[model samples]
Target: MNFHPSHPLQAFWNLAAAPIQAMALEQALEHRLFTLLAQPATAASVAQQLGLNAASTAVWLDLLWSMDLLVRHVPAGKAEPGYAASPLAARFFVDASPENCAQSWQYRARSLARFAMQWCTLLREGFEPDGRTKEGAAASTGSWAQAAREQIGQEQRVVTAPAVLHLMDALPPLPRQGRFLDLGGGPGHVAIALARRLPGWRGTVCDQSETAEVAQDNIRAAGLSDSLEAMGRDLSHEAIGGGCDLIWCSSVLHFLHDPQAALSKMFEALKPGGLLLLAHAELADDPVLAARVMPFYAGVMLRGNHLPQPGEVAGMMARAGFAGIHALGRIDFPMAPVWVHMGRRP
Candidate 1:
């Protein structure tokens, strides 16, 4: 038998050290280090430009390189090496890139980190209702509105829009000219993308008053004011307006007081033979897949929100009088993969 040396605690140690890596990335983002490193620059030059300590900056650059966020280059006869943003950093982290999601990423990271710190206490004593949800509908709406203005729009524009567009390709042909509702649409980027794809179609985005205002601004900026409108209403209490052809709702059901009733509301809102595309992260059987989803939504579940199990949403849709229901597999979202289900009202 061959003997091998191993450390049993390696995994735990890595888990313990995970925050160090996160902080390193956060600091780089905070200082706009990747923007500066977009082009190759020596540590000394970077330190001078950013007013960072010379020796410490060199060490930090090496750490970033080790993390694969930056690349290092050595020039002939040069004592110092040059560092530049790695391909991954250049594409997603650089400020100049249109696909930049650094701000949005940071927003989610900070929020999750705060929640993570409270996990032990929450598990022991349960969560206290906060302004995010425990308060009245007005306060919850306010929180979502803030997210819309701050990071939701960026996430939608850079991440959700593309994934939704790709998913739509798999659906059967949609009508050339029809009305659609973007349920819980933040900033209305998804609706704008659809409108651009289906030029003859008009669309509505419904959310809280403040979030709807954000969507309205985006609609006007996209030059879609003529065809798209934003409706401000409490979806839980108020009726989501009647819709004709299509409805695209994603990640909204988890927060609703009664997901089944909301599905029924959507059923009544749709025209006969209308399509409903519902996308949300569901608890998975596979541990790896579950890990992709659970951590991001652990706080939500702890706060008394429902994270659906696999095939759970489809059952609710069926109970609500939707027909031709089927799962459309999973699609990548900002932090996790969401299962998409399609149903039609008969």
Candidate 2:
């Protein structure tokens, strides 16, 4: 007997999905449990109301039961247990629940499902110049400003922008510090965070003119302008100036139609051995559960930017001719996971 040695390159293995499970779940979500949980109903009553044949309805119920999507409960003075939406579904699946993020995320999920269904055609037809986006779909529903107007938004901590790498705490202090450049910085959240950690560092937050105005106001509000500041630059087409030590590209790439090109430009702006920190939206640790949550953002990326994967990110940095690459911490704050990748110019 003989065994093969490992290949010197990445392996591309085919994934065989159990479509039966997915189909069962989809059917239950759409038909039986969708309205049945409006009030307690037996499987037979649900089937009758939804027009599902007894056999098919039984199969759907069984699948939900096995998956813990529904619980069988015995009503008082009743012999058989009546079926009801499981605890998980009651809180999350019910559309009327105020706790449901479905409205905020429904657009995302629908977009992904449409794309995944046509992925084969997409690969073959290639992408249009604007990008491979679905028509009529908009990115993130609205701009950050629109969100702020609706949700007391001003400039609050959604989360860290350019996440600090572990090396920040481990590496020896540097002899000279350059100006920090934060692209797509909102309300100076990143600059303030960085200033707190590095007193000697001066920073700039560059964004659209309107956003820049907001960010500048936020920087002054924090009294960090003694060290950090803000600027307005359209990074999509403009050449950003230099004299920067570390450039923070947080949550910007997912909105970039050409992330690699932007990364190259970022690399060009850095001095030798200067750092380029990047943060982008990522999937959760549980791949299956995240399948429902993360891919929705793909629509937002498709319509607006390209949310690159970790491997794609590393490859982009490499193509930018950066070195000393590092992986930093992740943000999985019950909403979505954001990946942090960084590198240094040689």
Candidate 3:
């Protein structure tokens, strides 16, 4: 009998070691290591500048190089190779980069790390619903408002705004002058982008009151106060104004207690033949792809929110009486791949 080692456990081992890699990157980010490596420098030089142990710094730099976050190159007349930020790191991790997302990245990393610690307890005894409804609402609003003020804007400017623009370019052109609605638009970055792209169109961003205030401030700052407005309304229960020519909603439905109802509301809000573009991450059929999505949303799921499966949102759209429903493929979002689904109100 030929003996074959069952599937190697390297994948599991890698999973076990994943936290170490994350910590390495976190430490580097905290130390502004990538910014320091914006220009190539020998590890000894890096150590001298950063006040780190030379030998340990060399090993750390090598690890980052292996991770492809840094590149090693030999400078003219130099025996020792120097490490610099890789293109990827330079674009996103370096503080001087226009599209830098290092702070937002760290915020998310810390959030997810905290969430990860709750998994065991959450699994054993499911999350308890907040009984104090008023307090919960206030807390939730404050958290979202804070995110709108800080983290969400960075993500939108760096990742989401460009993705939305690219996705819009692929679709059929809308009217030059029409009413547009951005549901759950935090800080109004997406709304601002769309407003700039369609100067003739008037836009409204709907979010929680505090968040909408943040969006309003952003709209004013962008000089779009004349054409763009933010509406503070609880979308799950309140009315979203009707006669919208286009509605752009992303990563929002899962947070609602009744997504189906929300879809119906969105359908009602649209004018006949209006377009609805919804972008959200659904649990994929492929294990690897699903793995990419699930961890980020696990807390949402544990908190009794619904994370849609593939085709699920489309089916909901169909039931909501949408016509010309179609999947627009996946957009590589900041943390995960989000499927864009389009439907027309007929």
Candidate 4:
């Protein structure tokens, strides 16, 4: 079955194939295949060392190699070829790499796989599995918050503070000693990075109570106590503290129950001429690519969260009394492209 959206019938068939691909990769991760394949070795050798069947190991290696997770080399005068981890696997699949995302994949495999089972029910019921009644909503909220904490490390590593810093560098100059607020910022990584770049700058990371705890730990670990702080506040219902020269809201608005209200609050929270940077994913720009590999995010959208179009966000900024509004679409993060909406309070 073709996972590519090139054919209509194949598209439907892909529904079955996508999860199979994810499961294969996750199973490989569990077996530490990538680590073993850091140096090229015959599949039989791998199987013998890992205590597995040689035939099955060879077939698995060939499958992963076809999927670009491995590379095979046939040595001259040797009867068997050796398999090695691909660059992608070495970088992201290996458990010991600094950029390893095995934990994130593991989380998805364990936690999100449950949601996939309810796709038909979600479509038929027109409500999330955990979003039926008030009690259900509360439970779902708690689950989401806990998920946020669990995924923060992975998210922080993937999206990266350096990436945010790069985005800031492309923009107009930021003020020195700026008062900044990282609204909905999990782990305060971006704020700490930005604060370091702009000397004497202090920023606060505001998020849900549980998420704030995670951010606090990150802040302490970074030794940024003097400049970065985490506040436990719900941005959807609460106003971010005022007097900020710059306010960064990353991957946040779409999840709020009322994005317009939050945007309005952000406008009020910013000082005159202060900049507000809204960073989020915009999948419509490349639907084919998104459909191919971003199935997990599709589930996220199904759960009442959203990824607003750039035009929609610009209109919201205009309505909120923000001027000089503009957007930089398709800012490449490690995992996906993010659209950035920048506006200045008049």
Candidate 5:
């Protein structure tokens, strides 16, 4: 039998070395190397600009160059090659660009470095012990809430914003000037975007107290203060204000310890015939992509959050008294794919 046993070890090493790539990219973003390298400069000059050691800086730059994130150049009569942002980096990594993805990279890098490595400990300890440990909890001083707000902005810009906008466009006609609810909406981007689309509609983004503050700021910044507002409400206990129209909930279900109860509450919050959009990533449907991103959600699950399986969400919606349920298929996002399941109150 012809078998290739020689490369079996290669997979192990590749998996081990994956973190280094993310960490290195994070460091580069932290140093604003791509921004500085908008113009070509030798490694020595780049190092001096960033106050980094020349040798170490050169190594990092060379690594990025090898990755094709940067391009090398040799000016006429110049001995050392200069480096600059690659075409891909120029369009996506530059801070001035509307499509900048630096925030997404930075957030993921920080999260992975801080939380992704604890899988063994998580498995052994049977999940994170701290029940109150939630994302964006900066510290006892509530500083983390602000950070969470910033991270949520990044998430909206990179992932949720586009998918939501696309889905809204594809949605069937609905009443104008209706009450729209963004359940567990962080930073309120989705609501703001939708409000922008439906000029007559008013929106409310509901989240925890800290996140509500951030969402308020985001609403004001988007110049939709008159049309949109943010409110603090815990769906697990507190009531989500009654509404007469559409409700959008994205990426919030999997994080709840008891999603079914929360969905039940949401169902009550909606008016008769009101629509609810529940969006999440369904792992079993796309194992190939899940293999790459499972660790991120796994880390959340380890923190005592519930990560739903493929069909669990649909079942939950049905049990929560939702009607006319339908699937919107997978939305291809810049970060990852998400499956949207919609239901209407009968």
Candidate 6:
């Protein structure tokens, strides 16, 4: 037998990280279960589709059930244990499902728990996350943003906006006469909601051209066009306008390549003592939560955006020159903990 020389224990150390192992298993199971569940097949049917025995089928179904991605049904007095896909699975797995979440994030999920190590290089190199592809700024190859945009157009994202507003209402009131900037304001619902709540406030719905158009349409629909402006712009490039007194980046930060830099930009955009409200999944706020259910949801952020330590929201705010950063209102994404970070620019 040939013996190979080993370098350092650090190599072995690298292989033994728990988070790495958990993330890997999570994605593999997700892909397997997501694809299977989307088929709208029973456990036995799925087993047939995947060429597995009924015993093995029940095991997979049990795993998905434990993960809350599947439901098992044994009709009264029946011997067969039927299975149905969970909402989480159906929302994004079944391509034809009206609630197909796959477009928004299904394709992107697996890429996270695997390829996100590239983010470390970004920090060392001081680059911005432009939602661009490796096509080298020419044809503009991208996977997440474009994919999410396409999917956002396709799927019905009904509960999320209200959920966001629900989170927002739980926060302290914005200062009077404050201009609120809604970065990547999807469909302008949050911004419209904010404007409606605070008649003294004005908003700019900032995002890419197409997304901004959708935001504009939403603003028009809300009859708050006069109070809001939709501007198509690249956040990773220029700094957001400084005229805004309050900045709100909701559900957009995770997709960023350099979330800290973006936070820094928001820090720069605010007036003295201004507030920056980050309304997102709070994935970065719960590092350990990644081991649980978020990998399913985070697969979207990971494929599209880098999910920092879920609990790193405070550290990120501090790095961005934010003072008095407060992360509050922890919620449940599966079993993982999520938080919203609110900070003030000193």
> Which consecutive 10 residues in model 5 have the weakest lDDT in total?
132-141
Clashes of 5: 1
Query: Residue 236's C-alpha lDDT in candidate 2?
Result: 79
**Which digits, one per residue and each the tens of the lDDT, describe model 4 over residues 1-346?**
8675577688678777767777778879989999988899998999999899999888888888889999998999999999999999999878788777787667767766787787788789866445378987668667656665555566566666767887877877865677899898876677778777877788899888777887888888888888889998978766677988889887787687788889998999899999999887666656775653366466657767776753888898899999999886556654456778889998
Put down candidate 3 lDDT per residue, 1-346, tens digits, no spaces. Answer: 8697556897898889888788878989989998888778999999999899999889988888888999998878989999999999999888888898887888898899999898898889888877558888789789879987887788998999999999999988878899999999999999999999999999999998899999999999999999999999998789999999999999999899899999999999999999999999998999999999998998888889989998999999999999999999999988999999999999
Which lDDT values do the candidates have, in the order given? Answer: 0.90, 0.65, 0.91, 0.79, 0.80, 0.65
Give each model a TM-score: 0.94, 0.55, 0.93, 0.87, 0.87, 0.56
TM-score of 1: 0.94
For residues 77-161, could you state the per-residue lDDT of candidate 6 as single tens digits? 9777767777876665565665555444534444553546666764476444465566755333233335434544343244445
- The collision pairs in model 2 are none
lDDT of 1: 0.90
Candidate 1 vs candidate 4: the lDDT winner is 1
Which 10 residues in a row give candidate 6 its minimum summed lDDT? 139-148
- Greater lDDT among 4 and 6 belongs to 4
Candidate maximizing lDDT: 3
- When sorted by TM-score, best at the front, the candidate numbers are 1, 3, 5, 4, 6, 2
Of the two candidates 1 and 3, the one with more favorable lDDT, higher being better, is 3
Instruction: State the number of backbone clashes in model 3.
Output: 0
lDDT of 2 at 235: 78
The TM-score obtained by model 2 is: 0.55
3 against 6, candidate with superior TM-score: 3
Q: Which stretches of candidate 2 lie over 4 Å from their true place?
A: 1-143, 146-158, 161-176, 283-286, 292-296
Of the pair 3 and 5, which is ahead by lDDT? 3
lDDT, residue 26, candidate 6 = 55
